[model samples]
Target: MKTYQDQIGNVLGLKKTPLRIVSLVPSQTELLVDLGLKDSIVGITKFCIHPSSLRKEKTIVGGTKTINTEKIKTLQPDIILCNKEENTKEIVEACLKIAPTHVSDIFTIDDVIELINQYGEIFDCVSKSSEILDDLTNKLTNFQQFIKGEKTIKVAYFIWKNPWMVAGNTTFINHLLELNNFENVFRDKERYPEVDITKRSSVDAILLSSEPYPFKEKHILELQKKLPNVKVILVDGEMFSWYGSRLLKAFEYFKTLRNSI
Candidate 1:
């Protein structure tokens, strides 16, 4: 058996390329399919909706934070994919008992690329992984060029409501927000934190995400009243947060978003 170390530095022994794959992370699930491993994917979480038909085709163990271990055990996967932030330690320990588990910890695009490369190594899909890396690097370069001269927009990105949480430091969403030249007002804070935006008078705009809470036009209108001087717009949550093959489209979406702003 060959030993492989994950992003978090945990090592697992694999006899061969993982043929029966179970992905617990939604973004990784999409990346696996894109890297030409769709046929090998036998299980996924309910949130893995990128391919749309994947949920119907694959057995869903459960959601990101919560999973059905019994369902996962029954699937009897050759390997399981997970993410540090998305899955709990309990989940990792649980999966490790069943099969070799690869956990990725990503806070930036570079980390995402490394994860892709690691997947290529373990799954033996080097060509496809290289293709994706090339495309992603090119798109990222184009975006950097486009955003070079753009004015930095001071914005607060909202991911949820009812307590009102915003993406802050050390998050994938914050990384993308910074790339879009949007200065997160909550940058000094760590992780997703609940805040009273009305107190943040320096914020120039408020961005409501379309997922994790599905902020809509009505919510935008509501915030507009509270922050009449500040611009409030609905942003695609996937484009800003998903750190996988979805990033292929994210760069293009960033171009559009900056233009609209």
Candidate 2:
């Protein structure tokens, strides 16, 4: 048997080729299903709601950060998939104690493509993964063309509401913003940080995400009132967060979003 590994800390040890797998990250869980590993996936987190039909068939382990160790052990996964950002270090350590685990840490488009290739190799679906990657690359290129020479709009992308946290420089959201000719106002911040409304006034736009906190249309009106000059838009969280096959469609979405802005 051979073993394979990726730069993002994901490792695939070929013993029996991972017949039963558990995916903790919602985005990665969806990616596995996209890669045609639906039957091989035995367990998923309660938060993995994409491909809604899988919700009925897959065993629910728990959330990404917290999992029922006993229940996961009972399912007896040959391989466990987790993400560094989505799952805590403690959770990954606990999962490793039960089975061979692969942890992925992604922050850029390149990292996402590499992850797709790695998953393809592990799941024996390289051609499909390559095709998906090609589609994503093309979309991204087109998005770049569409946004070329556009003024860099200063934008604050809020992920949470109460504490008012906005995506910072190091996150994938920040990268997407840059791709769309939008300069992240909080580039000085290392990660997602709780921001003050007064400080947020400088941005030209306020982007409210549809997940993590499910920012709704009403929230847009609320934010618009607070920041009258800034354009408030409801953005799809998956477009910025999924980092997999979903990225193929995200560029076109971003293009439409840019036009709307």
Candidate 3:
């Protein structure tokens, strides 16, 4: 058996490359497919909609926070992919009972690269993964060049409504904002925090994300009324938050966004 340690230091003993794989994380599911493991992935959560075809062909165990244990058991996967922030401890423990589980804890671009490398080894697709990493590295380099001398705009990125949550420090979204040269107003706070929009009078712009809560044009207009002078724009949540093969396109998106602003 081959022994591998995941990002969180959990050791996995694989008899062979995982054939019947189940992915609980949406971004990781896309990465697996990009690594040429689409057929190998037998199951996924309902949120794994990158390939689109996977939803039709693959068995969906359930949502990210909730899982159908019976459905997962029925799939009889050799390996299960999960994320520390995305999946509950209970789900991880339960998955371990069925097969070797690899849980990734990603906070930065470096961590994403490491996860890709780990997947390469885990799925025996080193060349394909390396190609992806190379492409991502090149794109990020270009973006860095593109953002040089760009004015740093103070921004607040809203991920959810109702309670009004903003992506704060120690998040992948914050890291992306930093890369884009945008100063996050919530940088002092940790994780996603409930924001008092009225108190945040210093922000130059309000970015409404297109996921988790699906912030739309109507929401943007409403927020615009709340902060009339501030620029309120609808941002693609996937480009800002997804830390996988999706990152291949994120830098390019960032370039365009920054250029517009």
Query: Best candidate, lDDT-wise?
Result: 1
Q: Candidate 2 on 196-236: residue-level lDDT in tens?
A: 86665578888898879899989988877877888888999
Q: Of 1 and 2, which scores higher on TM-score?
A: 1
Task: Show how many residue pairs clash in every candidate, following the order shown.
Answer: 0, 0, 0
* TM-score (C-alpha, index-matched) for candidate 1: 0.98
Ranking of models by lDDT: 1, 3, 2
Task: Give the worst 10-residue stretch by lDDT in candidate 1.
Answer: 252-261
Global local distance difference test of model 2:
0.86
lDDT (Cα, 0-100) at 129 in candidate 2 = 88
Clashing pairs in 3: none
By the lDDT metric, which is better: model 1 or model 3?
1
The lDDT for every candidate, in the order shown, is 0.93, 0.86, 0.92
Error of 3 at 75 (Å): 1.2
* Candidate 1 lDDT, 88-152, residue by residue in tens: 99999999999999999999999999999999899999999999999999999999999999999
